[model samples]
Target chain A: MKLTILGCYSATPRTLNNTTSQVLEINNHMFLIDCGEGTQVQLRKHKIKFNRIKHIFISHLHGDHFFGLVGLISTFRLLTREADLHIYGPKGIKEVVTLQMKLADSWTNYKLIFHELTSENSELIFEDDLVEVHTIPLNHRVYTNGFLFKEKEGDRKLDINAVEAANINIAYYTKLKQGFNVKNNDGVLIDNKKVTTPANKPKSYAFCSDTMYKEDIVPIIKNVDVLYHESTFLEKHAHLGPKTKHSTAKEAAKIARLANTGTLLLGHYSTRYDGLKAFKEEAQEVFNNVELSEDGKTFEFN
Target chain B: MKLTILGCYSATPRTLNNTTSQVLEINNHMFLIDCGEGTQVQLRKHKIKFNRIKHIFISHLHGDHFFGLVGLISTFRLLTREADLHIYGPKGIKEVVTLQMKLADSWTNYKLIFHELTSENSELIFEDDLVEVHTIPLNHRVYTNGFLFKEKEGDRKLDINAVEAANINIAYYTKLKQGFNVKNNDGVLIDNKKVTTPANKPKSYAFCSDTMYKEDIVPIIKNVDVLYHESTFLEKHAHLGPKTKHSTAKEAAKIARLANTGTLLLGHYSTRYDGLKAFKEEAQEVFNNVELSEDGKTFEFN
Candidate 1:
């Protein structure tokens, strides 16, 4: 899986910075997270194919988080896109979007589906044979939820040479891939582990933004290969409670440490702070594998 | 009167171009013409003081023209703006804007007043002592109206030297400024023109966009100092008649010429045509004083 950061600033979009947005490419599927304003322009600047974006997941209804959704949809229509677009967001997204379309008198020719989320528990929002998406309830100013994308464990790979040496029949190859000992035509016993190897390993990514430091999300995002979390404040503003619904760099690292995540990507920085080196220094005190998220930056995950 | 082009392109925002939105400075008040996507960012890029924007006038509800209204409104709330915001647009604008605010649970702290336009004829939308705003009925896919911002005829200028020469009393100064002749203590008749020059020669600016060439608007915007007309295409695509509810550059110029506007500013270009010079060339054929608008460009009418 490859992750690209389209924007990571907090609140406003400046000339040199942007708001929250990211792209996750997993199992040949593209998913957009938190499409802030000017995301399309950032996508174009990063050379990301606009048509490849299929699934859009919004964290909340905040202007900075999802205001660009309408423009992106309209742009898709203007470009005459025929591919169906699926948006998973909080409730009321459809009404706002459809109302704009009704006023403009221009509706999309392709299928436009909105999956509104009002659930408070971690539930499967989307699932295919290869990938599953679950919501990670977060504490924020509004009804917000983070997403956990996990890849299913792959089937066991068959060792053709070992199977042949064991005299396993061709028809028994399927059983071997399923990690089952197979009986050949000669009625000989075959060990499953001797003739089979492990298949591709599963990977998981978690996305969280505009949320306070909450311990509950640790269980939901535990052991994630990568975690993209918001760090809106610094330790100097620790007096601002989690009720403010904003986390500092140290708080984000604490969550990553508790979750035992492989890597932590921090963003959603308040514009007040100019340098990001402080964030790294603060986060490194708790989590060793921490990195800053930059616009148009991409990451590779195994 | 001053007009600032925050964004002038049409169709969709690209990495290098943006949709429709402009800032009109009239009678010392900042009025937002349209709120396209990325308008706040454009406002920032132009170094415009966001708080100065007190009123917003939307010509129509096309996504390209008004999609950014919600974001701009939300941004004001986030910035803790206390000034009341007044919005005037077609029917349903209030519903759409308030709906988003309700969903996000982030309504503005300041008063947000909505004035829905339902009239088919011209009506005064806003009026102060110095400025008056009227609707210039337009023909489009939806109920639309262009805006006419006219500086109310100023109080007659008191030609100071002429007033003294006429022995005009100081009490008659206010009357002379109002363009009225008043008697002095000496019973001398002071001509209004003799007392004052012109009260700044009330300037007028008309903004018409996303409409076909309709002769009906000529009388409403006649002799306006500056007229911004939407030109989505060049003469080559003029075959798409008023049915499409759009005008070519030449068609826009024809309306400007018919209205006898001081200068014609053409914009809202279709992305299909890469070169913008064609629009100027096509418009110059009909109107002698034609200007091309681009993002971040400003026009000062003096």
Candidate 2:
């Protein structure tokens, strides 16, 4: 799995910093999250293929989070895209986007599908053979959600020497890989565990942003391989977190500690902060495995 | 009058080129014209004071022409701007902008006034003591209008020596500046022309964009100090100009020549072209006084 931070700063875009947006490549799919203004330029600057973004997930309707979506969609149409694009966001997203297209009198030649998410409970939003995505309800000034992406476990690996020693026929090899014992050519039952081993463990990633520090999400994101949470403020401005429905670096670290995620990635720093090093320093006090996200930064997870 | 080209390219904004947007400074008023995507960043890059832009004129509802407007307005709110902003555009602009703000639950503290234009004929849209802004109707796929900004004639220069030689009273100096012949203290008429020369010929600037080659606007923008017209393509792609309702550089030059504009500024070049030199070269074939606009380029008119 690979993750690229196109923009991580919060509120408004600046000459040197951008608002919220990122690209995640997992299970052969590229997912765009929270396309803030100027996301397309950032994508081009980072050399990310525009058509590779098949699915877009928006956290909220805030301009800093989703204002770039319409422009990106329009650019895709101007490029004469043929692939189907899916957008998953809150209920009002479809109306807002379609209205703009209607006014401009320009419609996408490709299939534009909207999956409006209204459920507050944790529910599966997207699933395929390789991956599954679920929503984590978040607390914010507006309707918002965090998405969790998990890769499905693959079939067990086959041990060629063990299978040949067991005299397992080619037809029974399929069953063995499925972790099932099958009858061999001599009518003797063969042990599947002796011939095959378990596949590699699946990895999962959770993205949360623009939400206050809430412990309830811990259960939903527990034990994820990587967790990205917004740290809009530092400990010095911890008092403003609750009022603004945003999280402090210390609060995000506490959530990371409670969820026990393998790695904690912090992003969406408010522009009021001078530098990002303070966020990492504050988060590290509570969570040892903490990393800071910067524009154009990339991370690879194995 | 001063004109600054924030972004002059057409279709889509790229890392190297931006879409249509400019700032015209006339009579102490900074008027923003056609704010395309990424305009705020462009403004920052150009170091334009945010508060200086009090009026925004959008030619049409196309994404490339006005997508950056909402983001700019939202940024103003974030900055706690107290000055009222006036936006002049097509009829649907207010609904489009207000809807986004409603969805985000973010309302501006400053008053945002919208002047929706629906007329197909040239009409005065804005006017104050120092300046008058009139819409120059244009032919395009969508309802569009080009703006003509005229600096109202200023008070005639006080020719202090001439006024003293005429023995005009201090109280009558104001009458001389207002182009009125006043009675001297000795009861003799003093000619105003002898005391003050005519004010610098009121400079006018016309902005025409996203329109096909149409001659009807000639009378409206005639004799303007500078004319900024969209030339999305060169003469080589003249066939595409009519179909797209855009003008070729040669066609823009034709308009400039017919309107007898002081200087013709060609902009909104299509990204397909290799460089901008071709646009100027093509336009200069028909018009002698021609200028090519680049991002951050400025033109001063006296």
Candidate 3:
């Protein structure tokens, strides 16, 4: 899985910075998450194949998180997209987008589907053969849900010596790799694990933004390959953090530590600060594998 | 009056260009006209006082014309704006904006007033002492209205020399400037016109965008100072002009000539064209004074 940070600044889009938006490429699916204002332009600058983004996951209704959605949808129509586009966001998203379409009188030629998320519990929103998406309920100013993209686990390993001894037929190789024992013409069983090698391990990515520091999500995202949580402020403003329901760098690190995720990606810095190194230093105090998510930056799970 | 063109391009906001948006500053009132996406960033780039923009006029509901409105409203609230903000647009605009606010659960502290326009006839939508705003009924794919910002005939010019010749007392001079004749103590009637040379002729700016070349509006914008009309395509594609409910440069200039306006400002160019000189050239074919609107450019109506 690969992740690209399209924009990650707190508050509103400024002359020099953008709001929240990111792209996650998992199992060949380019999923856009949290589109803010100017996100379409960012998509163009990043050279991401926007047409490939069939699904969009919006965490909440914060302007910074999803203000750019309407523009992006309009642009897609203008670009003459033919593929069915799916949007999974908080409730009322359908009204906002459909109203704009109704006002413009420029509806799309392709199917425009809206999956308004009103559920408070974790549920599957999208799934394919290789990947599955689940909502991670979060505590925020509005009904919010973080997303978890997990790759389906593959078959177990095989033993080459056992396969040769059992004289497993080449036609049953696939079945053996799928962990199914095959019976040869000699009436001998060839154990699946003894004939096939294990498939590549699956990876997971969890995204949480504009939410308070909630540990209830730890179990859902525990041991995930990559966990990106918003760090809107620093510990110095910890008191203000609670008032705004935003987390500090230290607070994000605490959650990452609790979840024991492979890596922690922190972003969504407040516009008040010019530099973001302080956040890195603060988060590093608790989690060693914490990385800062910069605009236009990309990360790949190893 | 000062005018700033934040995004003068037609259609969608591209990677390198934006859509329609402008700011007409009249009598210290910052009036935002047509907010396209990335308009807030442009507002910041031009150092515009976002808080001072109490009134926003949207020509229509096309994404290119008003997609940025919600973001702007959200930004204003995030900035803690206390002043009441007024939005004037087609009917159903209030529903679109307020619903987003409701979903975000971030209502503004400032009073947000919406003036939904549905009239097909010309009428005054906004009026103050120094400036008056009138709707210029437009023909488009959707119900649209053009806005005309005419500087109320300059607060009756003093005409000091004329006042002195008429022996009009300073106190009565105020009455003369108000277009009223006053009788002096000697029972002499001081003609208001004789005391105050016709106050500086009001300079009116008519904005007609996304409209067909309809000459019926000539009488409405007759003899205005400046006219900003949409010239989406050059005469080369003039065949599609009327069908699409759009105007060509030549057509726009024809309106300016028939209206006998002082200047014709051509904008909303189609992205298909690489240059704007053709638009100006086409307009000049009908009217002598024609200018092209460029993004980030300003036209000071001194």
Global fold similarity of model 3 (TM-score): 0.92
RMSD of each: 2.3, 1.4, 3.0
lDDT of 1 by residue, A192-264 (tens): 9988899888999999888999999999999999998899888998767475798999999999999999999
lDDT of each: 0.89, 0.93, 0.89
> Against the hidden true structure, what lDDT does model 3 obtain?
0.89
TM-score for each candidate, following the candidate numbering: 0.94, 0.98, 0.92
| Model 2 per-residue lDDT tens digits across residues B1-302 | 99999999988889988899999999899999999999999999899999999999999999999999999999999999999999999999999999999999999999999999999899999999999999999999889999999999899989999888778789988888899999987889988888899898899999999899999999999998899999999888999988999999999999999999999999999999898898899899999999999998998876
lDDT of 3 by residue, A25-84 (tens): 988899999999999999998999879999999999999999999999998888899999
Q: Write the per-residue lDDT of candidate 2 for residues A1-302, one digit (tens) a residue.
A: 99999999998888999999999999898999999999999999999999999999999999999989999999999999999999999999999999999989998999999999999898898999989999999999999999999999978999999888888789777778889998877889988888899987988999998899989999999999999999999988899998999999889899999999999999999998788899999999999999999999999999
Report the TM-score for the A-chain of model 2.
Answer: 0.96
lDDT for residue B141 in candidate 2, whole number 0-100: 88
Off by over 4 Å in 2: A164-167, A170-173, A183-188
lDDT score for residue B37 of model 2: 91
CA lDDT of A260 in candidate 1? 94
Recovery fraction of native interface contacts for candidate 1: 0.86
Report residue A289 deviation for candidate 3 (angstroms).
Answer: 0.8
DockQ of the candidate models in sequence: 0.73, 0.82, 0.71
Instruction: Provide chain B's TM-score, model 3.
Output: 0.91
- Which portions of model 3 miss their true places by more than 4 Å? A154-170, A179-196, B156-199
Better of 1 and 3 by TM-score: 1
